[model samples]
Target: MLNRIIQQFGLQVQSINEVEDSHSSTVYKCTLSSGENVFLKIPYTKLKYQRELEAYEILKGRVSIPDMLEYWTGDEDCPGAFLLSELKGKPLTSKGSPTVAFQVGVLQAKMHTIHPPAEKVLNGIRNEYTNWSHFIENQFYSFAKDVEDVLPPQLYKRAIEKFEEMKHQLPPPDGPSFVHMDFRPANIIVDNNKVSGIIDFESVRFGSTEMDFTKLYRDFLCLDTTLYESYREGYNSIRTLIDLEEVLPFYQFTDAFNSIGWCKRRGMEKNALFLEENVSIIKNFIL
Candidate 1:
């Protein structure tokens, strides 16, 4: 099947390296006859394929996204797959300096400024809500239900009640923007201290900037103060300054709750406990 796909691209396959294999997708790093490298992503489902294809089609010139060469749904000759130009960089590791965070912030700001027509953007679960407060309120409660069994009952009750109070205090909904709903270091490729490309757009949707900023803060801020500060500095240069005082702790609670549920489902007890601890810290803030 791979050989057939390679022929469709008019390339002679020199070798193929399996880079990722998971329940959702299989990815390969392919070396072509001309010694050029390309990446192929074969989604386990058709729905995943469509989401990624829509992203490539819409985000081409506006962002530092990969160049899609070809996309095919499975048939007799070929299986479901999409091929992209291999970006020249490595996935970011925690070892890199915090300066990269500033660059990421700039890229995110640029991405958010892009407002395509509503008709053009695909309908996404997150994007459906015009009211940001409603979205977070619903998500908080929904996630509460999901994590109820694993989360301590007292903490869970406290979180739900506090969120109810906080929801009313939430500011008016921010304007909709193109949001990379899963903005994390793992999804970014860096070279020479600059973000060369952003990948994995399956979670791309129209939503609030808070959705993206949550990850940057939750993951990178603890490593270095400069990471969060520089990111904010870069972002403010393009967009209006975000009220970090208001949004950070609120979104931290949201992310922690979400992570706790995920860890419980995967039977990752230690990670769940870590997130549970963070949830406790957030609960203290509310008190």
Candidate 2:
């Protein structure tokens, strides 16, 4: 299958190195015959391929994202893959610092400026939504199904109540905005302490801007008072930072809840530590 793609594009390869593997995609750094380098990404599902394809189109000129060089929508025997221009940098670790947090905030604010693409720019994307809440609600319902057997009855009931109670209270962005639904420290690539690129757009969608800040704050910015303030300063430099005090807790709670479902789908026992962590987080939200 890979041979067919390389042959079709006439990609004369010298060396191929597997870089990152996740539930959604298998990525590799491939050196071409001409000594140039590129990334080959094979998405685990068709939905991920479509979502990322549209996302790259929306973000190419607006921010520092990888350029889509070539792609193949393969058939039953061959899975689809993307050949993208490489963005050189080391990915930040999960333990984010003030510098990483600030850059992330600045980059996210920049991304918020990108609205939904013109109809002409998109392919047939099945994931389009009218409002961000509907998108989130749909996600909650779906995740709920995956973890119904695992979460305690009382916690599960309250989680649903919390989402129902707070989901409606959250406001959409001033405009329909592109959100990196899975943004985190590991996804941010840096060089010399500056953000060089933002990768992984498979989970990208048009959603509330505040929704984008959940994982960033939970995993990084909230680590220290100075880090939180620095992130805000960086974000404010690009565009006005929205008031999160009123709205952030809701997203935080739901994100933690969503994490449980994520673990269940992958394998609860293998992801037990992460699963335990999210369960602890959910308790904090309810308590």
Candidate 3:
């Protein structure tokens, strides 16, 4: 397999080391004989591979995505993959510096400025714009079975009722724009307190910018208040920041519920327990 990749890219391979923490794709760090380095991502799904390639094409100069060196759509003998210029950075950690968090916000705000693509991208929230109430309600309804399967039926029923009532009072999305739907710390890369790049573009879609902040609330806010404040400040510097306080809880509920469903399906009992705890936390915000 290494030989095939080396031959395909016409490179004198020095080493191919598997990258950790890549779930959807088999990622490798390749060091060429010339001492230059590149990263290869072979996606398990063809659609995701194509989306990542297209995302890079669209974001090449505007954002801090890695430079694409080569893209291959594989045959039966191999899998589809792409090579990118090796970026120097580490994933954002729990103790991420304020600068890193601020930069994350700035970068995310910049991405939100990019116009939505001609073709609608898949979004967690329903794409229809006429009614946000219907959107959230419908979204929860679709997950009703999964919610029941993973959570206590009484809690699930009560949560649904609360969500239905609150949905009507929520405001409509301001507009659709390019959003990194999975904009969490892990997806951001930093070096020396500065952001070098953002990875994992398969979840890029046209949606409300508020959706991105849900991750900030779920994954970063409690870990570091400074990160959240700095991020909010930085984002407000570029564009009108969404009032995340108004929408964050609802989005967090959806994310947590979806995670629980995934965990239950995979028989990840511990993971499901953690997510159930999160749901309990989110319920307070709604009720």
RMSD of 1: 3.6
Q: After superposition, how far is residue 277 of candidate 3 from its true place, in Å?
A: 4.5
By summed lDDT, the worst window of 10 consecutive residues in model 3 runs over 122-131
Better of 1 and 2 by lDDT: 2
lDDT of 2 at 275: 93
Per-structure clash totals for the candidates = 0, 0, 0
Ranking by lDDT: 2, 3, 1
* lDDT tens digits, residue span 157-243, model 2: 988998898877866544467778878777788876678879898877665677788877777777788889988988898999889
- Model 2's alpha-carbon lDDT is 0.80
- The model with the greatest TM-score is 2
Sequence-dependent TM-score of model 1: 0.82
TM-score to true structure, per model: 0.82, 0.89, 0.84
lDDT of 1 by residue, 1-287 (tens): 66766766676788998884132467889988899899888775666667778778778898898899887777754447888898788876676566787777778888888664666646432363376676677766676766787657887787777667665665655558877777777777899787897887766666777667777665665578777788778777788756867766667767777766666655666465666675576567555
Error of 1 at 130 (Å): 1.3
